[model samples]
Target: MIIDCHNHVLATALPPGHDRFVREMRAPGHRRAGRLPAYRPATDEDWVGLEGDLDPIDPGTLVDDHVSAGVDRATVLAVAPSTYTAYGERGTIDLGRVTDVDGPLEVAKSNDYIASLTRRHPELIGMSAVNPKFRGVEWARDELTRAVGELGLQGLKLYPMYDHYAPADRDLAFPIYERAVELGIGVMVHMGTSSAKDTVLDYGRPGALDEVARHFPDLPLLVCHAGFPWVDECLAMVARHDNTYLDISMFATKSTQRQLYEFLLRARQLGCPLSRICWGTDYPGGGKPAVLLPKLTLVNDVADPGAPISRLDVANMVGGNWARFAGLTDWSEQETLEQLEAWEPRWRDS
Candidate 1:
């Protein structure tokens, strides 16, 4: 089964506005503007507004798109960017402003919306979002418990960079992790690469999750985007911790095909189990499964690869890994992973 592990079905009636790629280009130090000349926005009018598409597609249409694209399932999530992004940009929030803030109510409503989708559609696996800093950790924990125990959400997703907080903040993040562990649900963290306006890059580093991984050794922790631009650290973390996994969300595009393929080869060369890594498209955010799916097998075309990447390797990335992470399959019974363990890297000696 082909599954996209990261996606958002936007709220149709009251979908939130977004900070787009162009706005990130407009930001003072966005690297894409400097590194990739073709992407640099050339007009003053492009900066007129920070918000982009409202992304309001009905939940049914999103499912149909997945089905028509040959994707068997997708993991859907709720993120309240409007609730926290703008307010958290400066990296500081007044304690007085959080308790009675309207953000938490919106956050709850969004979680409920995802919960509804999960109940109605078997194809969509749902996850709830929480910003412990935007609302108190206690309240966030309570909501997480309710979301999992009652609403039937499969996991919890945290957006630290967008919300301006470090992932390892013991006081703010630890409690939420503890709660997720108790609930027996996996946690997906938005680590690595944020093109959004006013995001703090330091907060998105995957290394921050190291301490969290150690604290909760048995909890399944997924580092979203595979910490691109710092993928070595991400691969190292995944190699080091049995509990850590990766969701390679945004790197499967035409622009990044080679970079991602090379990284996976090196990761395999170093013995990082590919079974622990899952493919994610960041759909509704950015990705076309129909386009990106074929790119995953580009590795096999390497004529002199040390050990040719098999179709199973691509399958693991496409859906098998995620099936295990989402509890649809037994992680212990994964037989092909043994074949991956014996595989070598690139054939050429550099």
Candidate 2:
């Protein structure tokens, strides 16, 4: 099936005034101010007019959007930015200050929220979020067990960029990785630049995952965003490591169509198996799939002059490969549509 391996259930409410962080990230040019020239915000008008449609951010709407867009399943990923700036060693926490404390609790709440949603929505899979530096290694291990064993999460999401640490920093994260290996869950590392204020760009180098993959060996390692500007390095990593996979999340966009298509073509030319690629919309950050799916489909179907990519290659890149990698069973987009014919009569023709 078309399983969106990376998505977020945009929380409608944040702890007090924490919405600014989300807003800053979503604000036009804020994410690429120092990077892309077209996105560089030069004035108040440039920033203010950039505020696009303000759609309601909730799980139900997200699911409806997915179903309407022909995606059968989605993995709702949780993010805990507070973990990096508040509860971890990358920064100091001010207990008495606003937006300064309760990183662990915030993460727990986010995980619980996803768990609750996934419990009700069979199409949704919840991936747990945990900071390896929370309290200590022992605490981190126990928390991971609680998240998987108790919370029923099926995947793990890690963002070392926010914490300003390399993905291969085993001293602080090895224990959590070990637990994830034991639980047979994949670990998705956010690679490339982040709009978060305290984020460190260098920490997101896709090569940082090399040591982590080497140490884990058997654990499923997903480098999200195809490592963006470091696409070549990420492709090399996937080629070198048997267990490493890259997800085309935010890259599967209209603006990035050519870049992403060329990367996929080069990846195949470089002998990186299409099976090592996964489809992810990075929903919310990727806007609606309706806008992206068409562009993504074009990338999958079109060819460069006479260098046409096969239909099987396109099929695998969209969903087949993800099912094989995620170990999902009896999954098929067509099968899901058939089931919908019997269940939701109105959706039969859709």
In candidate 1, position 117 carries an lDDT of 70
CA RMSD of each candidate after superposition: 7.8, 6.1
Which residue pairs clash within candidate 2? Answer: none
Estimate every model's Cα lDDT from 0 to 1. Answer: 0.68, 0.68
Tell how far residue 110 is off in model 2, in angstroms. Answer: 2.2
Model 1 C-alpha lDDT per residue in residues 1-350, reported as the tens digit of each score: 67789986753122222323333433543234453235665353544343334334456766886766556788897673235444322211111221222443343465677776777788888888877866688888998888788888888888888777789998888999999889888899989877565678998888999999999998899998888777888888888888889987775552466666677777887667888888877775465666555556445654245766666767688778777766666333244344323222311110
Best model per TM-score: 2
Tens-digit lDDT track for model 2 on 1-350?
66788887755223332344455566554445543235454444544544442232466777898888777788888663344362232211121222212445344465666677788788888887777655666776776788789989887888778755567777877877898899888888899766656567988889988888899998998899888878888888889899989988886742477766787788987777877888788888776766565455556444578776555565566676777666667667565344433433333323
**Candidate 1 accuracy as TM-score:** 0.78
| Model 2 whole-model lDDT (C-alpha atoms) | 0.68
Off by over 4 Å in 1: 11-52, 80-84, 87-105, 254-256, 303-306, 330-350
- Backbone clash count for every predicted candidate, in the order shown: 0, 0
- Off-target runs (Cα >4 Å) in candidate 2 are 12-17, 29-56, 81-105, 332-350
